[model samples]
Target chain A: MFAEVLTIGDELLTGHTVDSNSAFIASKLTEQGYWVRRITTVGDDVEEIKAVVGEILARKPEVLVISGGLGPTHDDVTMLAVAEALGRKLVLCEKCLERIKAFYEKLYSEGYIDDPSLNEGRKKMAYLPEGAEPLENTGGAAPGAFIEHKGVKIFVLPGMPREMKAMLEKEVLPRLGRRKFLQRKFLAEITDESKLAPILREALERFNVRIHSSPKGFGKYIGLIIFAEDEGELEKTVEYLESRGIRLEEA
Target chain B: MFAEVLTIGDELLTGHTVDSNSAFIASKLTEQGYWVRRITTVGDDVEEIKAVVGEILARKPEVLVISGGLGPTHDDVTMLAVAEALGRKLVLCEKCLERIKAFYEKLYSEGYIDDPSLNEGRKKMAYLPEGAEPLENTGGAAPGAFIEHKGVKIFVLPGMPREMKAMLEKEVLPRLGRRKFLQRKFLAEITDESKLAPILREALERFNVRIHSSPKGFGKYIGLIIFAEDEGELEKTVEYLESRGIRLEEA
Candidate 1:
């Protein structure tokens, strides 16, 4: 299945934070056989977030993974933007309210907080898009979300790396089907890629392999490396190129 | 002025490579007073690249910095996608060809390459979008590009971090103007953000300062931070909050 990742935060856009989140999520999705088509990062502006959300949702990829903007702070607006894009209302989820209350009460008992009463900032965390199921968060205060809006399966994740990983593994992956991809890397001792241009083109048309050649320096020749569907297909590709006199040494 | 970054690569989309190029560019742009609005990554597929380019260009940010997919490999279609997005044709530029020739000849003289003749793979680097001015590459064969298309100043940089940084510093920065942002972080001993919500909201409305509150765990409180346009404004913010009985320790 094709997928897309949308991460929201001004820190990422301004270079205050590195987006290790997208890479981590995309890799996990790739391991599950999903082709992540895009990873987009936008700031915390409501209009910008809503515009990007609407644009991405319209494309309608099978899997849509969203991270960040799911907190009690002023800038945390991903949930609100998603709800606006889906034309849904922001309503307080009862389960989430209970969870937030319990979390705070437990903290109060442990001398973590001065009081157990819910404040506007903390209470706001419980307000999710209507009909959205709260994805449990064992490591953080804001609960994640899993909602299928307009037939698009979305996994709303927190920006904190620890919480995002936990929610995706324990809550999201178990519900999705899996896929696989076969890939191989090769290096050759040839000086010119033009010498094997025709062979590389032929391999692409013949075996349907997605060809990617990394030519280092001026005269180095290519050993057309490919990502095929299976080991048999990759072997067939190697044989086809070798038959064309393009001997490749695996790197 | 506002800006955006578009990074092109299949390796990045599939999580085979972590994209640090956008952050580098974004941080540099931020230092120059440009507010980077977004950073988007797409695969090597020409259609995908073209589509994203079109979408980004339509928004028409003041500055657009693109990195990656500028090499001679089969997957390097970023230049072609950009040309199509601007409704331009791919044409060979004499300067780039000369640079490529000189680059290869140097490699040949240094015993790096078997021959100095331009191969099809190497020749492809010269065929940029028509009328594009080639940026000097001190670290590689592929030259970057700086073109003003549809009123947006676009810099098409190489995927290699070394070459991208050199071109941006030497060729791009000197011609552009710079802006500045003033920021301050604070640590507080308060447990509830609701205690300071009214004052923080007032600072946002009274001044243009963007306030962000970070709340950690149950008993701990928010560390209110402010991003102002000048040091004086930041100082005013610190005084304003402290005067309201909201004690903040500068971090």
Candidate 2:
């Protein structure tokens, strides 16, 4: 299956925040044998988000994972954008409200908070799209939501990396079980990438592999990746490279 | 000015590579007072690249920064896709050839290597669009290229973070100078973010501020960021908060 990640936040665009959520989601989706086709980061603008979502959906990716803008703030407009993109309506989820209220009551009883802000933060999590499944969030006040529209599953997650990760692991992964796929990575300690062209070409000719070479730190080391759909084919390609004395390392 | 970043590579899509180039470009663009509207990462597939480029151009961003797929591998199809997107022809550049050859000669004179792979690598860097200007790479074998198409200035930098960063700072930044912008960050030591909502809303009401309350480890503290376009307004808002006995720590 193919997927695309949409990270929404103006802070990311203004350099006030670094987008670690996309990287984290990409890694997890890849580990689960899903091809994360594209990642798009947009500001909190509704028009921009809608435009990007439309473009991504046109590409026909099976899954669309979105992170950020799920807080109790003015800039948190991800839910509205998602509803607009999917041609749906925003509705206050009763279950989500109950969960949020329960969380606030627990926090108040534990003396963590004593003011009305607890209910305010909890209320923020209650707004979601119609016919959405609220994912349990153990890390923060915002509960994630998942909605499937026109064969594309969209997951709306929090911008916080820890909370996004926790929800993905606990809620998203179970729904998307294992699939048949292959991924191989090679780490080479070569100083020059120019010298590896012929070897790379030869490897590609022998196997149906997508090869990517990325140099790091003045060409101190280069990361070579080989992706394929068949596991045996991937192994054979790695073995062929090993025979040519090109060291193969796993990521 | 507004900008968009396009990173092309299968390794990025398959999770074999973590794209650091977009983050680096975003930070640089932000520092230069340019709003990075979106950062789109896609595979090396030509159709995917074409689609993203088309959408980005349609949005009419002032600048479009592209990284990755500049290598000599089979999956290195960014140049072709870019050419197709701009309706331009891929042509070998004479100056780029001289630069690449000179780079190889320098390496050879320094007793690095006398292999023919150097020439191949240089030839790879010499290929450019018909009217594109080649950006020199003092760090690696791949030289970047710059093209202005339909009012959107597109820069093609190597996927490697170091090379992309060096080229962006040395070439891209000086061309696109600085702009006046206001950025304010406050670190609140409160374990509960609920206590800060009212004050945050108050700060926003006083100034055009977007506050991001990022809770850190075990709810120890919430890092607050208030970014605006007016420095005086931000200062007034901060002073108001401080005067109200709301402890504001400079970030």
By TM-score, who's the top model here? 1
Candidate 2 per-residue lDDT over residues B1-251, each given as its tens digit = 68998988776676556677787788788777777888889888888898889988998999999998876555677887888888888898888777667766777677665543444654766788778988887776677888988888899888877777888888777777566465667887665665566777777776776566666543546777766677877788778877766677998
Instruction: Rate residue A9 of model 2 by lDDT.
Output: 85
Model 2 RMSD vs true structure: 3.2
Best by DockQ: 1
Measured with C-alpha atoms, the lDDT of residue A54 in candidate 1 is 88
Candidate 1 TM-score versus the reference: 0.91
Q: Which regions of candidate 1 deviate over 4 angstroms?
A: A106-116, A184-198, A215-225, A229-232, A245-251, B180-198, B213-225, B229-234, B245-251
Which model scores highest in lDDT? 1
Q: What lDDT, from 0 to 1, does candidate 1 have? A: 0.81
lDDT of candidate 1 over A58-177, digit per residue (tens): 898888999997876667788888888788899988889899889878877888778788877678889888888889988777888888977788888998888899998999888678
In candidate 1 chain B, what residue range of length 10 has the lowest lDDT sum? B216-225
Off by over 4 Å in 2: A116-118, A187-208, A215-223, A235-251, B110-118, B188-213, B216-222, B236-247
TM-score of chain A of each: 0.85, 0.90
